[model samples]
Target: MSGRTRLRGRFQLFATLLVTLVQLPTVLWLCWLTRTPLPLAVAVPVSFPYLRQLQSPWHTTAPALSTYLALGWWAACAVFDVLMLPAALAVQAGLPRGVTWGVAGAIALVLGTDSVLGRPRLRKRVVHVEGLSPELDGYRIGQLSDVHCGPHAPESRVSSWVARLNALDLDLVTVTGDLITHGSSHVEAVARALGGLRAKDGAFACMGNHDYFTDGEHLVRELERQGVTVLRNRGVVVQRGGARLYVAGVDDTWTSRHDVARALAKRPEGVPTVLLAHDPDLFPEAQARSVELTLSGHTHGGQLGVPGVRRLSLARFVSRWTAGLYRQGRSWLYVNRGAGTTGPPARLGAPAELAVITLRRA
Candidate 1:
């Protein structure tokens, strides 16, 4: 490695060490409160990285009971850090201890309930296209995005989601990427489940940043092997009842694979077209290309926001297109709330989504 790279790695290690050390006080407090021993408390943080490595695809070995217990302890410690730190600070600031504790408890309860019970639900929407043919009007398309199939979103859970999607009787199904996160171990099962989607026009998918991160080429091959089309910067013409609807998808923008022109290349003019992009930020480019409707899902609706209020999402701080349908000029964009969670596997206020969007002639 280059000198700069080596130095960066060393700095990262040092930073991790510092952070872990700083959590010592909180860890001790938690251990005391729960009547746990100090030695075990220390092992939680030390074994967290070890447990993660053991669970990774490269390990090829099952984790032991101790590692599993360590993992749970680490998760509990992490949760305490997130939920109790503010309350602890409030107590230090002369706030009523009971009030502060109550606030923290209420917040934890709310987030816990949301994360555990907020299953993905079917959300329906209608989009009016300016020149949509009668033959293609009322066409239904199911969209599944950000289905991060890993430890948090297991194969069985994703398969169930696909089963529900199949029941919708969609003409076409589009998966807007983020198919897998953390590793490629679950790619085959996830691909097989997605392939089971029943639609007249079939299922198609575009890449997401996580897919690129976790072996994009292998994911494409697996999905293709299961008979699901994976679109990478390309367009295809779908015909039904003597009318044509152009469907296209660009590669993930985050990975620098975004090529709107390339995706829409050689498209016949005046055909109603839809673009499936993982990021809603691409909506401007899609609109510029005169694409009728663009489907996206990357923000997960901030993964924490009030229901029915997309603008209130924390993702709004970074992008205006957090979730929901947005219209500009004659083009429209719909951002799915995503079907899975990343990181903590917790979502508050904002629920997971399985969107079924219908197209109509304006």
Candidate 2:
């Protein structure tokens, strides 16, 4: 290898070692302090395995583990900072100490504030797309994805999301993926909530990875019952004002099979085709199929980002187009940050967003 290449390799190795050192100790310390025997045992065996995966030459798995480690450490630190504040404050008062307690207190305060803050501020991104075929300009498409409607997102939040989308006066509203968390019981309720959305074209959706974890078939049937077209590897041609647009959907990569060729088989020639794939990784396939635009959302813009640095390393491996608009050769990919929160329901720098894309002829 060249000298520069060797230097880069060495720097990567050093970074890996530093990350392992930080993560192993934090995990062990948290396990010890929390008296969580299960986590300790789990952490011990998985530590080397995880580190090995992190150090792997393959970019795919390594970045994913790195992201998991970073997020895990941040979450653990936040928890400890919250739980140990009183004792740390007392210790600080008893002796002259530095501002570690104060720093921890600040993190705890932010965590608490986020917990009670419900949803992050929603922003409408109006993207004007030119070069649309047949003067198919001024077409509005509303996007909502990653609605993990369970404990963190109740029916009320789902209702709010539906209401917001309904008020957008969109030509069509499309939910890319991640409709519900788990269980078939919540599927109907989620569908009912989302059914309130209104658009002249229609509301369509595809299965996400989470949907398969739950009952995918049941969820699809439930959503279809609620007037939303559950497009599983399917395509539909929509015509308006002397112009036609082809809209297609594919299943999640991790779950149910995705057949891009099948989805695009019957699409009309030269019509602007838009695809909805749950994961952004499908962009390459969409581009190969000559798709004009694609919409997706599964990363949630890392859900918790620190400014200036890429938050989710997993997303980087999957797609450079993690959030916002990206060009893949001639095709365009837009990944929404997401409409709702999952798990802890805390968003730091990355706020939830609803994308309103308007297409026009170039």
Candidate 3:
């Protein structure tokens, strides 16, 4: 009868409907792929979210860890549906059953390689920016984003990332956000690992939606304690000799409101500013303020795409600025594919990235 109870009912109904809808494709593929339908395996992933939402007291509000983890498993199985679509098309085109089976096997192999190997490796890249501050020209800013630490990505990987970044000998560093996936029990350990990262002008970060999922402030405090600047809707001037580089950050545009103007208020009109934002959709606003560069990561490049092709992804269904570089007017936005996984432990086409953005004066 209460509004809260009504909302909970609606959410449960919606989740149940979703699970039912997805079941057809998931079940069809399991029978087609494995040649044996395992009822227990199918039910565990497909029904977990729906059941968890219905059973838990916080049905409409906060979700339990098991719920989040179940979502991950469900997401992984979604790929099987995608593969099945193509297989169905092939069958419709009069392909032999034997040929379709071969295709399914190939798909499984690709998925295995990507989830086990490609997604875990730390990929390095260089981005060249035009009109970068000459004082900062050739200056390397290491970027680590979407560190969905906890279950999918652990503290050990975070420590390894820190060692890798320190080895780069970067002049400046920024973590675009999502340092913690859903909670912050090991936030201090992750922060301590990040503390080992050495940069001439120090390391900075912004917040992401996932960070706020659970005790986000705890992670922020730990980061600060470890000497990393948690820039939340604030700006600071970085000096190397007499040259000045403006650095600022705004809270996540999707999770929380992004106050771009508030962040750049104290910044001069054009002082070669670098804004740390979690979502690339904020680029237009940053461009309005003449921000030279913006760094972000949230999409994880959809976590599944054509490996050789790279740019194509389901993530594009939601965001055109899902990953990679884009220029509008004088401002440039670089959306790192992110360093960790969320939802599912698998990443298909998009590999984890460690960006070294070099300021190149043209």
Candidate 4:
């Protein structure tokens, strides 16, 4: 089965148990505290339906507004479950009512603060490579990933993101995929926004799982039409200051279409190389190929990561390489946190970002 299918099965079971155990108890506790039947009726009605709607048909083709609303509603439900599960258990174990509600409320406040105010920002990182050619040193690459440029992804948001990216002069720009959330309808606006990106060597891209959910080939063509290089199991060489750098891109691994060898086969002998991949699952293979660097951005940093601890997201279970920079011997990988939101249109602890990475010869 596909990754989505496996995750869907697990998510459904987790959701069912969460609602049956956690949310239901939270509602009962609120009703008891208020001593009002009205709260009991309103609490369940307002929240439960959204979770139900979001479930099933893992592949969705609904209106953008409704889908956004449903996702937001689901977000609220998820927050409640995460906060109340322990509280509910404590209450059952005869904890004081005040203590139970206080704990739940505190957790809610922390998560709430993150979701509302965690705006997207630029992150500048200096990565040092041992054998980086001096001519290629100081090379800067701007990364934008998981834009999910669909009906729910606004033109204004993308426009501002593009403006910010262009503001940072970069030697190259790489788009790590999920550019179009749905079909070709949103491709034009997304492409228009990214078309503003400026870099000396130009922007390159690779497909993500969401891109292939519909007609992926069309999306690739549209991106190409916008002057963006959509590299699928291919490699290209770009010259910079008398030095040649090899860049390669692979298709999405989630769909079993990624062929690391096919992509690396085109690299010119003895050239330093960088790779653009949508999912980080192929990092091991890239290391085997001795690729100098790899860029990917599918996890969105789990859409909720602990501020101090980067790897504390549900996405960790999916891929050990969730977000941020990772080094395996000589090969290095940096996963972008994404420039757009997908399901809930909200980011909590894990905020969206435009990454600017500078390379230095170590």
Question: Which candidate should be chosen as best, given TM-score against the real structure?
Answer: 4
| Over 4 Å off, model 2 | 1-112, 115-120, 126-130, 133-135, 308-314, 317-319
lDDT tens string, model 2, 20-131? 5544544565577568867556544544443443422322233434444443444444444444656467666784333554555466546535533536444554444445
* TM-scores of the candidates in the order shown: 0.73, 0.68, 0.72, 0.78
Which prediction has more favorable TM-score, 2 or 3? Answer: 3
| lDDT at residue 79 of model 1 (Cα atoms) | 47
What value of lDDT does candidate 3 attain over all alpha carbons?
A: 0.75
For model 1, the superposed segments whose C-alpha errors exceed 4 Å read 1-111
lDDT scores for all predictions? Answer: 0.79, 0.71, 0.75, 0.77
lDDT of 1 at 287: 93
lDDT tens string, model 4, 152-194? 5666778788778778878999899888777667877887787
lDDT of 2: 0.71
Candidate 2, backbone clash total: 1
TM-score of 2: 0.68
Ranking by lDDT: 1, 4, 3, 2
lDDT of 3 by residue, 23-95 (tens): 5676666666578768446666645654644623222222445554444444445556667778778888999
Candidate 1 residues 214-275, lDDT tens each? 88888999999998898899989999989998899999888799899999996789998889
